[model samples]
Target: MKRIMLIVSYNGANYCGWQKQNNAISIEEVINTKLKELLKEDICVIGASRTDAGVHAKGNVAVFDTETTIPPEKIAYALNARLPQDIRIQESREVRADFHPRYDKNNKKYSYRILNTKINVPIYNEYTMHASNYLDIELMKNAAQYIVGEHDFKSFCAANTGVKTTVREVYSLEITKNNNDIITIEITGNGFLYNMVRIIVGTLIQVGTGKIKPEYVAEIIAAKDRSKAGPTAKAKGLTLEEIYY
Candidate 1:
C-alpha cells in the first residue's frame, strides 16, 4: 500500500467537524466514504488538524493508505468529481510510507475574520463574524506582541481540553483591517491547544474595543488562567489556512 496525502478545502458549514462522529456528518467521514467507493477498498484518512465545527479550511492535510493503481497526482481530479462542491481536494500525491499526518512535526497558520461595521453585510455573513462596534486594530497589534513567542498558553486554551500540556510556541500574530471593513487576524504557530486561536482572537477583540488594556495581555499570560482571558471567538470566523510540514 502507498500513502497518499490530500490537501482538502471545505466550507465546513454543514459538517460537525473534521473528525467522524456517530450521528453527525464530518469531512473525514465523507472523504473516507467517497474514497472507499472510488478505490473499491476500505480507506481511512488521518488528518493533521482536527478543526472545530463551522471552521473553514483552505488547505487542510490528510494522509491515507491505498492499494489502488491510480497515479497520486490524478487522485485529486477523480476525487473532486465525486466530492460535493463545498468540499474539494486541492492536491494529492504519494507520501513516504511511514509519514503520519498527526504525529509528524508541522506548523500551522490560522486566520480569524471579522466584519467590523455598524451594519452586518449579508453576503459575507456565513464566513465572517460580525462585529458592530468599530475596532481599533492598532491596539490589537500592540497586544499581539505579548503573544508572539513560546509560552504556556493555558489562558487561551478552552476548558476541559484534555491535553497533556498547554505550552506551545507562536511564531507570529498579525492584525490588519481592509477597506471593506474586514478585520483579519493571522497567526502562525508550532502548535495550538483546543480553541486557542479563537480565544486569542477574542482577547485581542477586547483589546481593540478598549475593554482590556494592551499591556494587560502580559498579565493574562502570566496568570495562565482560562477565566482570566476573554471569551472564545465564534468558530465560523476561524479558518485553517495552511499547514507547513
Candidate 2:
C-alpha cells in the first residue's frame, strides 16, 4: 500500500464541514465517495483541518492509503473528474507511509474578508461578510498587534472546544483596506482553536466600531474568558488561505 497526500480546495457554502457526518453532507464524505467509486475500493481520507460550516479553503490537505496502480500525481486529475464543482483536488503526491496531514502540519494562514459598504455587493454576498457601517481601519490595525505574539487565546475560542491549551503563536496579523469598502484581515499562526479566527475577527470589528478599545484586546486575552470576547463572525467570511508543512 502507498500513502498519497491530496491538497484540496473547496467552496464550503453547500456542505456541513470537512469531516464525514452521518446526518449531513460534508466535503470529505463527497470526496471519499467519489474516490471509492473511481478506485473501486473503500478509502477513508483524513483531513488536515476540520474547517467550520460555510468556511472555504484554498489549500486544505488530506491523506489516504491506496493500493491502486494509478500514479500519485494523476490522482488529483482523476478525482476532480468525479468530484463536485465546488470541491476540487488541487494537487496530489505520494509520501512516506507514516506521513499524516494533521499531525505534521507546520503553520496555517487564514483570512477574513469584510465588505464595509452601505449596500452589499451581490457578487460577494456568498463569500464576504457585509458590514453596513464604516469601520475605523486604524483601530482594527492597532488591535491586530496585540495578537501577534504567543498568548492564551481562550477568549477567542468557542466554548467547550476541548483544547487543554489555548496558547498559539500569531506570526503576523495584518489588516488592509483594498478599496473604500473592502477590508481584509490576514492572519498567520502556528495553530488555531475552534472558531478562534472568527472570534478574533469579531473582536477586531468591535474595536473598529468603537464598541471596544484597541487596548482592550490585551484585557480580553488576559481574561481568558470567552464571554469577554466579541461574537463569532460569520463563517462564510473566513477562508483557509494556505498551510505550510
Which candidate gets the maximum lDDT versus the true structure? Answer: 1
Model 1 quality (TM-score):
0.99
Give per-residue CA lDDT, model 2, range 88-207, as digits (tens): 999999999999888996799999999999898889877799999889989999999998999999999999888768999999999988855789999999999999999999999999
TM-score of each candidate? 0.99, 0.98
Clashing pairs in 2: none
C-alpha lDDT score of every prediction, in listed order: 0.94, 0.93
In candidate 2, stretches whose alpha carbon ends up further than 4 angstroms from where it belongs are none
Q: Which ten residues in a row have the lowest lDDT in candidate 1?
A: 125-134
Q: For every candidate structure, what is the RMSD over all alpha carbons to the true structure, in angstroms?
A: 0.7, 0.9
The CA lDDT at 63 in model 1 is 96
Give the per-residue lDDT digits (tens) of candidate 1, residues 1-245: 99999999999989999999989999999999999999999998999999889999998999999999999999999999999999999999999999987889999999999999999999997689999988899999999999999999999998888988899999999988899999999999999999999999999999999999999999999999999999999999999999998
Off by over 4 Å in 1: none
Alpha-carbon deviation at 96 in model 2, angstroms: 0.9
Worst 10 residues of 2 by lDDT: 174-183
Number of the top candidate by TM-score? 1
